[model samples]
Target chain A: MKTQPLVIAGRTFASRLFTGTGKFSSSALMEEALLASGSELVTVALKRVNVADADDDILRHLGHPQFSLLPNTSGVRTAKEAVFAAQLAREALETNWLKLEIHPDPKYLLPDPVETLRAAEELVKLGFVVLPYVHADPVLCKRLEEAGVAAVMPLGAPIGSNKGLLTREFLEIIIGQSRVPVVVDAGLGAPRTPPPPSKWAPTRCW
Target chain B: MSFRPIFESHPWDDVKASIYAKTGADVERALAAPRRTLDDFRALISPAAAPYLEQMAQLSQQRTRQRFGHTVQLYVPLYLSNECQNICTYCGFSLDNKIARRTLSSVEMLAEAAVLKGWGYEHVLLVTGEANQTVGVDYLEKALRTLRPHFAHLSMEVQPLDQEDYERLIPEGLNTVLVYQETYHQDDYKKHHPKGKKSNFHYRLDTPDRLGRAGIHKMGLGVLIGLEDWRTDCFYAALHLDYLERTYWQTKYSLSFPRLRPAEGMLQPKVEMSDRELVQLICAYRLLSDEVELSLSTRENPTFRDHVVQLGITSLSAGSKTNPGGYAVAPESLEQFEISDERSPAAIAAMLRRQGLEPVWKDWDATLTALAR
Candidate 1:
């Protein structure tokens, strides 16, 4: 049986997999792995690509017709910086879809829920499809939904930790409560245990 | 808000003892750690880490190359004045030195700038002895106005000024300020700077805070290497750097290691920092922070400066004149300190190219700051 397509911000994704472009040894290898994953949505960090350069290595590899770019404000630490970087990325990458990430603490890469909520509200008002990466806190998820974010991406663990579903209980709560599509964005180590097919399936996993 | 509290808390003796107490195990731990801390910096600069010089040098070279690439920013110092009210014990420009004091007139300053421009220097450091009367904010403002159109970047190594003065000069195209705490040891500091405004250790210590608050683009920091225990003094410098970096996140910081050089009738260096030890200190700084610009001045010998470009140095001064009008206007004047490397700027640029590094003359522009405004 065919599964239902995940719809977010008036766009439908045929594949449930969302891929991230980081930590690959080579851009070619990253492109190969992403193609193999068959992800229709890919997240690219604004810090990683020289957005002004059309021939940037990462941008050069991500020209596939099926993929839609989600530019992320990854290195920004405050609502002000997030807004500035989002505007720059929107202009450079030519995309209104943004991954609003504001992590003041660099060591843990934990999202600042307050700054995230503030930036998300502003960005949504500015007509952006804002997808905010946040902790698997159900309350924060509901707050982001109220802020009019396009989607809520809750982490399974600290970013790049390779520890799957460390916040499983909170993820379940966020999935149950969130009105927008809930995407599991970080720290899924392996594909062994996908959340069992159910009414509260994650919109996409990266 | 100021670095004074943090500076006072890290007392010299306590910091010295902690650094000297670092064992070989601590050095190894620091070397192996992926992300180093200030404690790791203490370990790296400790005498116990001398045997690991090669390892530290390799890491420093790699880190420097990764961050700054194969280029060395070239700058020349334009000595605007030798006038001073401070009686620094080790300086020829001291008030009690009884030498003819000279402050370059606007015409003389323009003449000096013409010579530096001829040498293809785009970054010029304006140096002056502490004389608020002769080389005060007004003099500096006019000098910057005269020279700003001739160069892309302007730095000053003059007397410490108030925050408002710095704020005023910054808009006049002053991009950088170098304020070295001659020594961090408070009592020893008093011994060096006996009288005059320099004797106020607290004010001198808090100058970086003032500069940061004034929104200066960059600030260079160091302690004159031969004053006290070099390791402890550097630790305090590093501490100050860490504080300022966190406090004023927008300002870029650079590090200079100026060992005491012989001047006419100047006091001898109490504690000598050998070339190997200086190398160790330079590498330690690179390992500590990958982004802080490491600068080598003309005080170092030609051979040493030639070799150090590959290590961790990001900026170098070529054909420097430490006396007012020493470049062309008044070559007979007594220099603040005798320059060891007298190589011309062209010679240094060629040497950098021979080592497969490009010599960058202009890396910043006033238009960029104007555009930001």
Candidate 2:
């Protein structure tokens, strides 16, 4: 039997492999890999793409029927700046679905729980679908849920470290406790290293 | 928090020992990794990576082409003054050095600017010694206002000023600031800068933080290569760059490799960095961060400058004059440091074209800064 489809913010996603639009050598290669993976939801960093240009390479590649864009605020340091960037992205990309990522620390790129919670609450109140990338802190997940975020994305390891499932126990806690969809983001380097199959499996992994 | 804390926390000797301890295997691992870290940078710059020079150069060229395209930005330095209050041991403009001191008048500054414009130069770097009395904030403000209408982009390499002073100059078309730490080794720093405000290492160390706080568009960083162990000083510069990029995400960064050149009454270079080692360092910087602009100045010979252009260097300063009014007004003034590559800007541009790369003269505009304001 086929697995049930994942739904987030009233939208249905058929594929479990949510991909990121970074680290690829070229946009064409990224599009080829993303299309082959059959991912319906993809995340792109707002800072990485030139939103002012209508024919921006990243945006042009993601202009497919199956793909839904998730613009992320990756470079912003504070909640105030994140909110401003989210509004700009919404206007530029014509999408209200945002992946809230506030990593003031650029080296490890660990998410700031305080800024993420603040931005998520503000974004939700602004009538936008908020999906925050955060640490695998169960308490932060509950707080984000209380903030009315559409989804909570927690790291399995440091972003891009390829150290799979370092936070398995914490992921379990977040998955069990999260009321909204829980998307496992960052550090799941390989496709085979997903958490053990359980009733509380994550809605998506990227 | 600022980079000062991170910089102060790391002991110099420990970092040096760790860098010298890197092996060929570590360099190979760093080269093969999909992503690189500061540790990888250390490994890349280590002596172990010397054998892999060809490979590093190839990777650096590829990364540079990918990010900056086949284009080299062109700039010229207009030395505003040779006057100084600081007694820098290696500098020709030291206060104790017996030399003619001169600061260009408004008319003389325009005369120099006019010559640069005639040579099709749009970017100019204003340089002066650490003489706050003669060429302080007020003098700098006047110079910027006078030259703002003449150039597309303006940068300064003067004494480090307060954050408020930097904020004051940005609106006057101050696009970039080049502040070299000279050397990051504290003991060596004190030895080189024994007198005046330049002797205050902490204040100079925190200049980049002030520039960042002032909301500058760009800043260039480096350490004078001959003062101490080149490898360790570069490692500290890379660390500072890492911290700045994170703390000031909006600001762009560039790196320069200024080896000590012979000048009047100059101290002998403590450590001589050979051409091959300098090439390796440049390539390593490119492989570390593909986006950081690498600039080559006229202090390098024509042959070496031509060779390194393709490796990773994104900017080049050609036909440089190191003294005030060296262009046309008064060419007899004592030069800052004798320029090695005396090729004119047009010749350099032709050389870049011969290599199938474009020479960009005006990559920025004042309107963008105006819009930002």
Say which candidate scores most in DockQ.
1
Give the alpha-carbon lDDT of every model: 0.86, 0.87
lDDT of 1 by residue, B1-373 (tens): 7888888788778999999999999999999998789999999999999999999999999878756656788999999999999888899899999888899998999899999988878799999999999999999999999988887789999999999999889878898999999899999999999999999999999999999888777899999989899999999999999998888876789999999999876788889999999999999999998778999999999999988889999999999999999988999998999999999999999898788776776665454333222
**RMSD in angstroms, all models?**
7.9, 7.8
lDDT of 1: 0.86
Highest TM-score scorer = 1
RMSD of 2: 7.8
Put down candidate 1 lDDT per residue, A10-91, tens digits, no spaces.
8888787788876453567778888888888889887556554577668899999988999888756678878887887898
Off by over 4 Å in 2: A1-206
Best model per lDDT: 2
lDDT of 2 by residue, B254-353 (tens): 9999999998888999999999999999999999987789999999999999999999999999999999999999998899999999999999998988
Deviation of model 2 at B274, angstroms: 0.6
Q: What is the lDDT of residue B231 in candidate 2?
A: 95
